[model samples]
Target chain A: MGKILQKPTGFYDKFVRKPGTYDQVTHYCPGCGHGRIHKLIAEAMQNLEIGDQTVFISPVGCSVFAYYYFDCGNIQSAHGRAPAVGTGVARSNPHAITISYQGDGDLGAIGTSEIIHAANRGERMTIIFVNNGIYGMTGGQMAPTTLPGQITSTTPYGRDAATTGLPMKMCEIISQLDAPVYVERTAVTDAKGIMKTKRAITKALKSQKEGYGFSFVEILSACPIGWKMSANDSIKRIEEEMIPYFPLKTFKDEIADRTPRPVVPVAPSQEDVLKALGHDQKEEILFKNDKKFIDDFTTQKVRIAGFGGQGVLMAGTTLGMLGMELGLDVTWLPSYGPEMRGGTANCHVVLSNKEVGSPVVESPNVLIAMNEPSLVEFEPSVTPGGLVIVNSSVVVGKCKRSDVTVLEIPMTEIADSCGLKAAANMASISAYLAFSKVIEKDQLVTLIKAKFKKKSLIEQNVAVIEAAYKYVSDHVRG
Target chain B: MTNDDKDIPRVEIIPEECKGCELCVTQCPKDCLYMSDKINQFGYNVACYTGESCTGCGICFYACPEPGTIKVFKK
Candidate 1:
């Protein structure tokens, strides 16, 4: 006698990925519809020969472990993001058939926008949406597809549409979109319904394999544990309660007439990507640093604080970029209030000879305080014998701590003399460089020229750097 | 169809994998499948097949949710 029916080759021979001793069985409860649906999909995959090229995107539900069963390229996406992730996979690998397997709570609730947009855009992917009435993995919470007046854990009383709105009909919504090639709503309550579901799944996958646009199959499934009923009763509930609200039918099927989507070109190369981002590969050597300045400062954790428009973040970025140009490991972390101009702002700049462990600078070795309030707030966190550069133009107070060296510079007046007030950040950078001797004075001017494209602005910034360097040498050192 | 016992169609249910949902037992038209009282390691009574009048219909194979639980052999 010949073997008529057996497990499909789409499933792993032994579910070694499944945890626990029962690798032979799924993690689903007894008589769960997920097992039936999974079997049908696997059978379809085996029959279609797309198992090797299929990318199964599992959602954040009980079926989150679908990767354990489906022996294909699997990606466990965040809740409701399967469609978005499926779009990426299908677009990136045009020959690969992507399956976004989602559940009611995932597709209908949190992932509504993702599903709608993915379908609307007509991404060449198949979305298998399992619409059980209640949330299964989360213990019978009210799902967007829950039947009206159906009692759930969240709805202690029966679900009242006046308050929580009616159950969402996703197939109806998807079929209304212009891009979908096939949209069907099937069930898995009986053998006939299961067969119909298999057919619908096969058709959906076929549409995707042929490069047809979006295809969706919403399968009305049963949740025995979530419904607080036996497997048999849950199947009956699907027939008697769920089918009336969600009628089983093909809402749209254009696969027979639709043409395959055009093949997407391969991704761009690294040099092309850099060029697209406005960077020339040849100019990369402009920032290359020789090791001559490495001994001046092996590492520096600098904190710059000021009002929003005072370019605190810009100053930190300048320092970080200088360190990066020197071939040192650097990180710039910005923290600012919600306002556009006047709110408090600060950024931490870390420059290290080795890989910087953490970007957060709790106790900075260098503090650039642009205003009096910033100096008062951040002076205490400076390490002993650290350097504090105060913007004496904006600050009227004196530094109380005698341990750390304080350099009070008129940054605003210096920037004004250089013909741009915003260039005060460049002045601060020049002062830091001059005092620390981390890099030569001309290096800061060259960096300014490389950073600013406008001739006038570059000239003014260079003037500010030179003037600030002169002030540091003549006033602070003298 | 042969009258020989070995030549007749039948189904074999893996006792360890059968979850005892009884969907197969209820859906079997030939009335050959039944739930046996022998509990397997996971502690549920598993479905069993009768030796006679087997038509080899694959309804029970599809009805049972657990994959590889039921394998049907046809005449």
Candidate 2:
């Protein structure tokens, strides 16, 4: 038997690392804002009492290992994918206080789509965007936040507005969105700047604890190495140059109050938790026949892969939740990579009566690859006698293996024709379901509408799903 | 937790370092830290040290800027 060591008490005490523990001795240059921002965020988490219920998403950059200092459940995102992953985390675990930390290059460049959409959708999470005016991690490169006339490796002779667009104001952009409850731009140039930064960081965190949707804090930080200046000079630049352009102020704060909601205590003996799990948790369940999938099938692994913004994960999760509603064992595992923002994303769904052996599917029985790249990437792994569905717009070739059946459907064209481009992802997923002959149309339609609460979206998605079902029935000749 | 019981830690504000952002004064769990009438070498009206009651939680240190400006030692 292994040794049973004694661990520490509550998460608070256990998480409090060392005196100078600032999230793995951050990769920031001397006098850089990353360390200060990290400390302030950690402190805010501590003060909010949401430390235990917090899950941080750190984008790939200098501070990728923000988890080391955060002392919480951390999801290290592929470069620029923090917002997408944070969206999933926040949506799945509504109780968790989700935080996404991204550099200017990560957030403003590759992650622009995810950040904008998440802010537009009003996800209840906190975003601490570190805008140091240049890409510090990747050898002092030009970033989206690089100011005019600011020289870097990418912009050697100083940025010219004629050549490069104006330095983006992310807080201003985010403030335009109605969903975000709070958006602020602050700096850490001087002692006073640090004070304002602390307040902004703390306020943004508090908004998340209060269930306010999408709080964003853009922190103008120092980049000593990238700015080609000494530590002291960088601070001076932040005061003299950075602050004038990115003024420190609250862009938007829609929250009625910043205080956290009081947790209502319950006497344990009085209420039934089982009933809450079974009956009170209302969600749509998808299954065929009177018997639930969990009670019938031993196991089922579903893989759905597609380009970014195609609702691939959403479709898989919606189906997974349907399985849950049918009292079937279900798990929705997301395939995350750097291609989250307008590139590609995927999810694996498992439905089973017994416990699943492995979540990773080297040879998935059912595969839905939206793009040509995804098919090329995942096609070799489809098991013989399995079904493979590819998006028609991208996939045009035949497979090498004849044992597996490949069903090509014009998902994008169909969705566009149906006046629902977003439904293309749903269409591909429905095609897989149709070919598999698992879970009938009526039940799936019911589940889809329930998952897609919007009436118009439900109508369009249902049409898209039905069209895919019809296409699968007509096409795929043996 | 009341201010009357004087067992809290004392807060020291280094005027030269304090930018007068009021983060400490505003964020104090107990509204004890305040600006003093006296001025420091920086010529800015700095925050005064109030030792009546304090919690040695080092929250002020976490918030303060000057590396050693705000120190909290137990009695």
Candidate 3:
């Protein structure tokens, strides 16, 4: 009797659960290459002693039961999302070895975009792609890797390149990308072929274990039952048919080894966080106590809408910044039209004493409409007792809703008079704050002073904002 | 009696683990291994040893797709 090699310690001795219970057996069909590939992967992980630290992400299609086999951390991802899931696991657990195992149907079709983006980012992970050239899970269907004359359930008349396009050469396509440290394609049909696959799996896993960036090992496997061929014939077909189109290759081996980046010595402090983000840099210099503070309000939903060049979003941001300074929760959500729009821009601002759920203000308590369309669109959604501040210069129509308090201020005209027409957003914000008393006048002036860093514009902008305060007080208060 | 402990290769096939793909049958240079009509518990016809001529080059051990299915002991 010869010595027996026990199953790789990385695998559970038995797959006991499900439709059947079997010890030391996989659910793969006869002549299917998944079993052989699994053996190679487990051997590599065991050799590297990374099973405990490895997280396997399995997508849809065959091999989705990866958690049932490899005795490691396993996550079942959506159809095309294994790579994305692997990225999250790798980034969060920097010491962990992440593996994304996928079938051709899952990766080549629905997951094409995700794989491309993940490879572009060079997430530290190993991707094992099993290409059997047909969709195995949902019955043999036309896959992106299905050959030209190959007939599947979908392509019953054989694949037409004109109608369905040619089979994607994924290994060659992925190798063209710059980030992957290693890109290879190996088969498992013959003894020599299986040996090649084993070596390729080992190297791919080693790349991840050494903290190398993305490495991919794609295996051209066979599906005898689906191909309607005998086990021997199926193995032969890979050598005769598949090898011609997808030549066994190592498209990349090792990149110019990158110098390991030095670890960060110290965590940045709270002060550093504020300084780097340019937030709260100028300390608690409050608005002057010249105006009354609104202590009664718990939450304020403000929507500012205007034309693209009107700086409408900045007006909402100033309020958002003020909410942060006041130790209140705030969110600023901007809505910019498409690049070709050359149209309108809007922002939704939510300021609250407690946690805010949705940043979108569906029915706002305040609507600052700077143009005719904005007033026409948002005037109906304002709360009955809420404020509707309109820039009378550009917005010609009046607010037909008499339930809300509508204040028509010639903000654009006033900014033009001040020779700072671009300062209309700041002027409008200052006027709204002056009337609402959410923040005092001096604090508003302090924020303007602290926010604008330009020498000439600081004074120029502050003058326009103060004029807004004076205009609101004389016209509305009188 | 002095030749009792000979340094010859002894090959073993875990009958239960063999998928009966016959990769070993094709790879064995000495033509000592063949597929038998007998089926193992996994329901596939298993590979059998001829017990006649095996140089034990370890080709079958390498060729068997299932890990640990074949082993060559030189003792």
The candidates score, on chain A by TM-score, as follows 0.91, 0.53, 0.83
Best by DockQ, which number?
1
- DockQ per candidate, 2 decimals: 0.64, 0.05, 0.27
For model 3, what TM-score is found for chain B?
0.84
Weakest 10 consecutive residues of candidate 2 chain A by summed lDDT: A1-10
Q: List the residue pairs that clash in candidate 2.
A: A23-A69, A286-A322, B8-B54, B9-B54
**lDDT of candidate 3 at residue A11, scale 0 to 100:** 77
Give candidates' CA RMSD values in order.
Answer: 2.9, 15.6, 4.9
**lDDT string, candidate 3, A125-234, tens digits:** 88999998999878899999999988999998999989999999888888888888889999987667878988999988887777688889999998887888876788
Give the CA lDDT, 0 to 100, for residue B49 in model 2: 60
Q: Which residue runs of candidate 2 sit more than 4 Å off their true CA positions?
A: A1-27, A257-478, B1-75
Q: All candidates' TM-scores? A: 0.90, 0.49, 0.80
Q: For residue A244, give model 2's deviation from the true position in Å.
A: 1.5
Cα lDDT tens digits for candidate 1, A229-282 = 888888899999999999999999998888898887668888889999988557
Off by over 4 Å in 3: A1-3, A16-20, A48-55, A71-99, A113-126, A175-183, A203-215, A249-276, A279-295, A338-342, A416-419, A453-456, A460-462, B1-75
lDDT of 1 at B37: 90
Q: Rank all candidate structures by their lDDT, best first, as comma-separated numbers.
A: 1, 3, 2
Give i-RMS (Å) per prediction: 1.4, 13.0, 3.8
